[model samples]
Structure formats: structure tokens, C-alpha cells
Target: MIWDNNFAVSIFPILLQGLWVTVQITLLGTLLAAVLGLVFAVLRRLAIPVLSQVVSFLVVFVRGTPLLVQAYVAFFVLPAYGVSFNALTTGIVVIGVNYSAYMAEVYRSGIQGVPKGQWEAATALSLPGVRTWGRIILPQAIRTVVPMLGNYLIQMFKDSAVLSAITVVELMATAQAIGSSSFRYIEPLTLAALLFLAVSYPASRLVNRLERRYAPQH
Candidate 1:
């Protein structure tokens, strides 16, 4: 056997503790991403002169950059300006912003998918702008994109491992620490992969089910 029984038992609890940190960050990060992504989508849709252009530039820049670099800047660089965030807070914010860029695309597609006739009718009725979105546009758009947003949430959960670079001690960090110190790479790493697969596979299946449920069929 590549890993013996006693070693597996010893490491499981430690990994679980780290996994809890991962779960907390993933939940917070996904929430932040969902809200910020929709904000970006809405701002671009408004086409509000210079503001829209700036939002567009920000979205493009975030989507173009590497997330790990963003994490570094959030963790290491921000402190130089006296804008310090602890490792956990930094990880959550960085991951949230990184995923928000992709989520913005999903939100844009969903908003665009709404029937043009719906938009026209809202305008024709002289509906207040915020009321139009709140009553008509966002409801339909958000429903259409729920499954896609869930997929990003799953991706963000996996990506949370990257936070270990900033020393957040998530699941991957726990595995690496154990492996390096004990010289048993296989068990801790294997355990971490199993934990991820166990959660992500079921979540993916749930997304598929949501797509099937929500997809508009002729």
C-alpha cells in the first residue's frame, strides 16, 4: 500500500481543519463575486459615458491578469501602502475579484439573453430605470444564469487552494505542510484531491440538473 492505515488516520483531522478554512473562504468569495460581477454587468449595460468605459477597462484588466499575481498584490503589496489585510481576508477578496471577472461575462450573456421585446416594453411604459431592472430585467436574467453562476462558484472553490501562496493554510497548504515535514507526499495530497473531487463532482451534477430544469426548451 502507498499509504498505511495509521498515517491516513493521523492526517485526516488536520486536513479537515484546513478544509474548513477553504470552505469559509470559498463561500465568502463566491458571494462577493456574485454581487460584484452583477454590478460590473449592470454598469456596462448602462453605457453611462466615462463610467461605463472605466468599468469596461477594469473588467478587461482583471480578466487578463493571473489570479496568483493578484493574490500576491493583495497580500504583499497592499501593506506597503498601509492597507493591510490578513491572509484569510486577502485570499477571500482576491479570489472574489478574480472570479468576478468571469462571472461578469456570464452575467452579461444572461442579461443579453433576455428578450429585446421585454426591454422595449419596459422603456415604452416609462418605467423608472431602477424599477425596470428590479421588476423585470434582473429577475429573468438572474434565473437564466443561476446554473452558470453555480459553475463559477465551484471553480472558485477549487481555486481557493491558490490562497495558500499567501499563507492562508487552506486544504492544499495543509497537505503540502504534512508532505514536506513527514516525507509522505502521497497520502496528504491524495486525501486533499479526494476531498475536492467529492465536493466538486456532486456540485457539477447539481449544476447539470439546474441547467436541465431552467433551460428554455422548444
Candidate 2:
């Protein structure tokens, strides 16, 4: 038979290990992206003379560049400048920062969607800027954008495969390694695709559910 079920069963455990690493990268990368994206969104919203413009430019630059190239720079070039991280660490950060540029726009849209009355009410209450944002504005803004963030989380999970190029032993990397060693690409590669679909399809459904749950009532 062309497909070897016994071999697939044997390699299942190893693939699971790589999947775990992929999950770690996705979770940590999304967390980092969420935090940094919020910071970027807030900085640009503040409209600080030069700072906001610089942040805006950086966001655009990151968005415009290819992620694979960025990963190469982080993995290869940064070490030359005395900035270095292990492959896994570099992958997580590069994915996070790459996603952050996109998330910043999502966050900006959320923040802008806040009711003008909310801002006026904050002013009338004499709330400090930080308190006004922390207490009133951000909570509402973040709620509206939660679904969008979840979508990005799903996207980053799939995109993590790109990090395999830099030797981060993710699912795709594991599959490739198995193929190279065994000269049998069919089972491992097919299994990897199935594994990805299994996770992403459910996650997308959950995101859709969240979108319905959080949508503003007419």
C-alpha cells in the first residue's frame, strides 16, 4: 500500500510534540501581539507630535514587509549586532511583532468606535486621562475587538509554519524532518495538514460565535 498506517501511528507521538511547540508559539505570540498592539494603538491615538508619527511609520513598515524576511533578520542578522535569542524565542517575538502591526489597526478601529458621549462623560467627571482610558474607554473598545483578535489568533497559528524555515521545530518542520529522514513524505505531510485543519476549523467557529455574542444590538 502507498500509505503506511503503522508508520504514521509510530510517528504520531513525535508530531504531537511538535504540535505542542506550535501551540506554545501561537499562545505566547498572540499574547505578546495583543499587548504590543494595544500599546501601539494607544501611542498613535495620543497624537504625540513626533512619537505618534514614528509609531505610525513603524507599523506601516512592519505591515508592508514579508514575515519570512523579518524572521530571517531576527534569526540571522540580529546576532551580528549583539542582540540574540534562541530560535524558538526569535520565532515567537518575530511572529508577535509582525502580527502586532496588523492588530494595531484593529485596535485603532475599536478605539475609534467608542461613543463620543463616553469621552464627554469622562471629561465631565474630571477623570484623569489614564483613569478615563483604563476605566471607561478601553474596556468598551477591547470588547468590540475581541472577536477580531481571536481571528488574528487563528491566523497566527497557521502562519507559525513560516518559523519552521529558521529551524523552529514546529509541526511543519517535524513533518519535513520525517520526510527527509524516512523518504516517505505522504503520511507525515498528510497528517500535518489534518492536524492543522482540526485545530483551525474549530477555532474559527469559536471566533464566529464570539462575534455574534459581542456584536452590538441594533
lDDT of 1 by residue, 32-151 (tens): 999999999999999999999999999999999989999999988899999987899989999999988888888898889889999999999999999999999898888878888879
**Which residues of candidate 1, in runs, are more than 4 Å off?**
none
Largest lDDT belongs to which candidate?
2
In candidate 2, position 54 carries an lDDT of: 100
Spell out the clash pairs found in candidate 2: none
**For model 2, how does the per-residue alpha-carbon lDDT over 1-218 read when each residue is reduced to its tens digit?**
99999999999999999999999999999999999999999999999999999999999999999999999999999999999999999999999999999999999998999999999999999999999999999998999889999999999999999999999999999999999999999999999999999999999999999999998542
Candidate 1: minimum summed lDDT over ten consecutive residues — where?
209-218
For candidate 2, what is the TM-score?
Answer: 0.98
For model 2, state the Cα shift of residue 104 in Å.
0.6
Clashing pairs in 1: none
Give the number of the best model, judged by TM-score: 2
Where does candidate 2 stray beyond 4 Å?
none
Looking at candidate 2, the ten consecutive residues that score lowest on lDDT are 209-218
